[model samples]
Target: MQVHIRYFSVYGSTQTYAEHLAGLLNTSAHPLEVPLPDDATPVIALSPVHGPVVQAATYARKIQGRPVAVAAVGMTLLDVAREKDSLRKLVPEHVARFYLPGKLEFSTMSTAHRATLASISTMLRAKPVKSANDKAMIAAMGTDTDRMDFAELQPIVQWVQSLR
Candidate 1:
């Protein structure tokens, strides 16, 4: 089966994953801004997760009832339970979900995004006790931190192949 790959990326990590997956599947990846090619093509949407938000949720909702899968890329690590809970809140339960690690490139971020991170960093610093994740976030504030791996696309690739 032919599949359509779309990505909504902020700092390019999600796009990188989408393109790599597309290459493996022998398809091309398009930005989410492009309209879907057809009704029957299964869609794999790779979107960045910023804190509580999954950037492509609105697009997913817009294309409801289609064969759609969402790959959420983020820096924060989560247990399986938390991942499920977060996905429930961010997208429709019917949508298949996957999580992938993402990179944070502070240098490439817009001024507004950087300022917002600075604010978040300040709030995190104010906390009396910090989790390991929080400490890592604090340390990565003004630098580029990458957690992406092309091997992580295997599950998505397997799922897409199953559709055939």
Candidate 2:
């Protein structure tokens, strides 16, 4: 089966995941800004935590009515996806979505992301989650980095392959 993994990544983790997934499947992935080929290849829309904002949804719509998958990477609570009503609606039916842990360097993220998070934290009357794990994650998220263990893609890859 032919597959097209098209993705948008603000911090690059999603793109890195897509590339690794494509390599494992022995198929090429596409850039989010590019046009998907007209041929009948199943499209996978991948994105980072920015969610529907990154136009992964718009890209998915271009290949709508075809078999497609949507996967997102983010700093998630273990069952965040299951609990999030908004995320449920954002991920389309033909789209198989999953989340992997994402770490963001305070310095590397766009000012908009940092500001938004800061605002959201303040509005919620909470400080950023200051767990030991969180601290380690952030410290490792050096400037100019979007590092992730490719193993996170395995479950989704196996599931997608099963669809063939």
Residue 77 displacement in candidate 1 (angstroms): 1.9
Considering summed lDDT, which 10 consecutive residues are worst modelled in model 2?
A: 136-145
* Cα lDDT, all candidates: 0.81, 0.66
- Please tell me which predicted candidate would have the highest lDDT against the true structure: 1
Residue-wise lDDT of candidate 1 within 19-123, one digit each (tens)?
A: 899899899999999888657778888898876778676677667556778888887764442445576666777777788878988878999989988999999
Taking all chains together, each candidate's TM-score versus the true structure is 0.89, 0.76
**So what's the TM-score on candidate 2?**
0.76
Q: 102-132, model 2: which lDDT tens digit per residue?
A: 6566777777777776564454444355654
Q: Which stretches of candidate 1 lie over 4 Å from their true place?
A: 78-85
